[model samples]
Target: MRGRVDEKLPMDGEACVQAMMNETTMTKLRAGKKKFKRSYRLQKDRETIVYSPTRHSALPECTKRLPAEQAYDVSNILEVFLSTLTSRSSRVDREKAVGPSNCFSISYKDQTPTLDLICTNPETAQTWVRGIQHLIQSRTGETIVNKKERWISEFFHAADKNQNERLDLKEATGLLKRMNVPISSSHIKERFQEVDQNGNGDLDLEEFGQLYRQLTFRQEVEDLFNRVSSPGGTMTMQDLHRFLTQEQKVQADAETCKRIINTYEQIGDVKANDCLSLQGFTLYLESKDGDIYNHAHDQEYQDMTQPLSHYFIASSHNTYLLEDQLRGPSSKEGYIRALQKGSRFLELDCWDGEGGEPVIYHGHTLTSKVLFKEVIEAINDYAFKASPYPVFLSLENHCSVEQQRTMSAHMRRILGSQICTDSDTPDPSVLPSPHSLRGKIIIKNKKLPPDVLEDEVSDEDEAAEIEDPEVQARMQAEKEKRRKELEKKKKKIKLAKELSDLVNVSQAKHFHSFQHSQEKDMACNMSSITENKAMDLVKRQAADFINHTKRQLVKIYPAGGRVDSSNMDPHVFWAAGCQIVAMNYQTPCDQMDLNLGKFRQNGGCGYVLKPEVLRKDYLKIDTSGKIPDKYRKNLTVRVISSFQLPSPSEKSTSSADPYVKVQICGIPADCAEQRTEWKKNSGFHAVWNVAMTFPLALPELAMLRFEVKDHDSMTASDMLGQFALPVDSIQQGYRHVHLLDKRGGDISPASLFVYISLQAP
Candidate 1:
């Protein structure tokens, strides 16, 4: 008989059970009232209400337990959005610097009469652009990124003194001076303009705003209109009138309202405690049957629906990113305005230090420094509305691998449930998910993978092959078709999956979900957190993470990764499974190390024995032609040079064999591997060098072979010649095939070749 609707739902399981009981009680009360049951009967606590705790406990009733399911709210999600917004300038400048020709960089938005808003999230940016596109499309049937800028925002007071078309030299100078901009008057004269109306002498507020919008939207509208309308003008006076009319305002407002309504409808549909994301909102907005508010008001509308705080700015900056941006003060404001206007997937060029500390400034010469913390703080305040954190972060690492890892690690820690750095999702219930990276943040790099690069590799290897006009045209057509198909499929799939994910099967338990972040983190005694206190919390925490940073790291560079030795692990495991083979062979490491010798004590392991590509590192061994890379250099054969003395007169062409008597320098004085006194100082001539000194690229190779005849038949294979040097033998050993050179030079892997023919057998 107990019943009620649970309001302050918790994230944990207990809170969910409580909510269920309350709902059931509410249902019963309605039934009872219809039957005309006495008020006293309905008031019976024993039958209608469940106590707060068990075991005869009535104390501490105010203490509430929230499961992890209800912890994060809009504020948290907004916090993330804003945190990502502050780096807009860096994002743009970075992109522009490395972007292709005609590619633009970061820009700002003029919102209020004086303020320039910054956008950090890229998806929200694209979404905003699409929204403007939609608006323009719906009204005039035109679409463009160019026109939206002109009609969008506020004004520069002094610059548009006359208000005719744009800011003129004198007025622009006054405006720039007023803004405390540090620039030459001559420069201002060249770039600034006079915003005058009716050929007037001075520009006013409206004129300023006019210039702002012109800078923002007029051109975009014109370009878009040109594409959609005939010469007669698609946006006729009638269309203009309709767009300006209150109905269109309502239509626009309705879109926003519809978004909220549809979102709530979807939320209501979700019986489980799953959280909403921008991706979800976009889908819900698309599915509305006319105006969602109008449709929902009739039958299914519920007053207890979730708010807009359910989602944060979408982060697409980390995706489809360019490599650089070159920006200045004027460019920054336009970028901010774009974010405020709701563009998603802002583009960026990023650099990560070896320590993973990422800096956002981009330019031919970096005159400014952008700390990651500063970016986080600005984004938190500007975009997320002090709540939801950004949903994605695309990054490029122009720095060291170690730095990339560090920057990546911090991103996971900061974004929390919104995004994650590791390639997997973290479970939510775990207080701080192990490596509790945020859920939605995504990062990317510019370097192509082997597979992609392979795809790009031209089989013909000549510009002429790709440049044939017919071939080029055909290829272009194919690319366009492929692109369109990819876009169509991606959208269709995303839309379908988004709608599917929105349906909440259970009204609780979302692993690392947004709705859950709230129920888990929301405190009953939160009123004490005043604005200043909240600001302080933001500044302190943001400062802690984004301030000046420097990091150093050491790691192993996979082949072709970079040209540095920053990655090295001195630790080596001499376990049983270790095997060895000759480098510079058609098939290296096939056979095995046949014995123990003084060479083992000299530290010979397959992993450490790199080709001579490394000798240039410290020894300054700049071999004539072969280039040195981190990975190849890490394994070059070095110590062998000490023992094998090459005859300078001998021509060491890879095709021609140059035999040199080389000592295996590491042999111990007592012949460590020699078993008895008879084998006191046994030694063998090393017939090869495993260095891949030859410059040939792939699958191509060369080899060096040795002919070893047993000096003493008794000592035979007991000698170390199978792997390294041999100890005391009557005739010692023959050094017939000394060193072989190929494209690179030397038989790297720097091991050996065996030849044995027993006397009687």
Candidate 2:
């Protein structure tokens, strides 16, 4: 009777076994002990996944959908930690914290949550663990710890044929090639220099590891194109057209489409039935002839013809602290990151430190300190890696005479031949351009004269002032205090001159009358003033300051009251052609955003050429505060559509209803931002027909920032991405405006199709 009953039972268990045999594996599990299993079914040619649930007694079926935007990040879950190793019995309630013996939790980057998941059985737990591991391995190439373990041991053994434990340039290049990173020889040289901090020509295991980690890896061209190719490993003309128009959102005309096909199609010459093979597409993307990077200028174009004062230099203030001015850790990372971002001018507030060495920190504050030699070493290693321009070190000297000498020696030693030590050279009437000072480090500080000492006093002078006894005594005491303070200042000035002697390229001086500045010609009389003082000067002596900046260098730093490290708008001073409009680089505000946009020009070399009018010593324009915008041009932008729009926030599940904002940020009163209406339920593909117009003054110095945002009714819109382009570089007609990430790297496959037009007023 039991055999007959078993034979007549339903075959749902067999159906579940058959479903398990499929490619997809089980993932989600029910909270209770009903033995529920859920697995994801990957949709073909899309990122979407379907959740199928099955019970021990029922057949498998898809119960829910997992959209791409809200999909679980199984790949980021690097490891699974069991409760036994993670939980502490004394600290945590055993019942609530460690729910079950079979329960486990996953850990990922910077996110270690406390949780336990219940598994029905050992087989179920093993299946889940295997599935997660496979997912992680399939997505991320390798964990950093694993890469470190394998890279040094495996790569060093393969490359060090001589068993010297170090590799020269040639060996390093070959090893990189073997790793499938086809880095250029020139790029390899730059990378070698950046890694070889001690100036040694060879890289040991540690240096090689550093280079290996920083080496940017692009997908092998062939592999990349093949992944996107259609059936038979070839893409048709229509396929390429759809990719450009749909995926990239680039509206290339018919002729342009044909040109692209001819450029990339590898099967044969482009014809009516021509198709693109993987090799051809790879060639197009990798070739220097492509429109993408145009690597031809990467190593070739080093513009040094313009004067140093003629370019708007990217500058940073209090560059040692990583956080607020009041309390922050002073590290060399700030200098490294700033220079890597193409900053040419760096400020250092130097004070005496341990063992007679100078240190960098926020003066009179609780911020931690770092050795001045470390900052110089960091600068030397990274100054020209991103931009081949010269670096200007603006020194705020607060050290004693002996410590000042130590600071100078450390700079000379760490920087070596890069420091400009030609103090005895005849002063030129005009300043040298960045072209002439490439790979050089110039110091800028106040050089006080020996005559700044106070006048001598005698008993005869004390008898001259005859008044009431109380008044006379009070005045004498005040006079004595002033004389002592003056004497101390004079002594400090003498010490300041010792450090200032190293400044041959630029000299920091006080701004007096315009005539006083013109009296000196040898030193390129540069002035470093607070933004408040600069604004006051502009209010009282606008014409004189503008005329002076045209010939000499002027750096405007944030006010002393900015304890929070807030930055002032650089455009206010940039309008007067102030060469170095310095700002606190660590702070992220509207001013910093504008600074990024202004320096995005000239290949981001941290030197942008000033407009012709601002470069001239005299202009027939108004001396009043108002800008003459009538003489400027008009800009018009037509927003068409956008594709592959990412979610506003990383935690958002639903797609965003995207919109566009066009802005011209600068000193002109007419500068304002305009936006297009939000596309209704557009999701990842937004389509709109709208135009925005703005009046631009000083087009050569102005910045056009394009912001893409997601519309929300409950809260303010979230910014997706932004791209800042110089007004002069705005390409006319139909073109794609590539979006840039917060760090200012191009975000491929994310773009806006727009028609840009400019008309002279």
**Best candidate according to TM-score:** 2
Q: How close is candidate 2 to the true structure, as a TM-score?
A: 0.59
Candidate 1: where are CA atoms >4 Å away? 1-324, 327-338, 352-356, 363-369, 386-390, 420-440, 444-761
lDDT by residue (34-123, candidate 2, tens digit) is: 233455433221122345444433533345552342233332353543332223321211122232234444443212232234454434
lDDT of 1 by residue, 1-761 (tens): 11111224223333322332331201101111111111111111111212122221322223354222111111111101111111333222221122112111222121211211122233322222232223323323221112122212122521343434455546655654443233568654433344554554444445554443333221322443354323543333333233323322223343454343334333443213232222232222222221111222222122111111111111122111111111222122222332342322232334453234655543222224355533543333233321122222323224344444445455445444444322343322221111222222323222222223111110100011112333335456465654454344221111111111211111111112223434452211001111222233333432211110000000111111111101111111000011111011111111111121211211211011122222112323222223234312111121111111222222231111222221221101111111111211112112232232212111001111122222243333211122222211101011112222211123211222211111111
Model 2, residue 578: what's the lDDT?
A: 80
Q: CA shift at 44, candidate 1, in angstroms?
A: 62
Q: For residue 88, give model 2's deviation from the true position in Å.
A: 36
Question: Where is model 1 poorest over a 10-residue stretch in terms of lDDT?
Answer: 548-557
Name the lDDT value of residue 638 in candidate 2.
78
For residue 461, give model 1's deviation from the true position in Å: 21
- The models' CA-based lDDT, in order, is 0.24, 0.62
Please list all clashing residue pairs in model 2, or write none if there are none: 304-435, 308-433
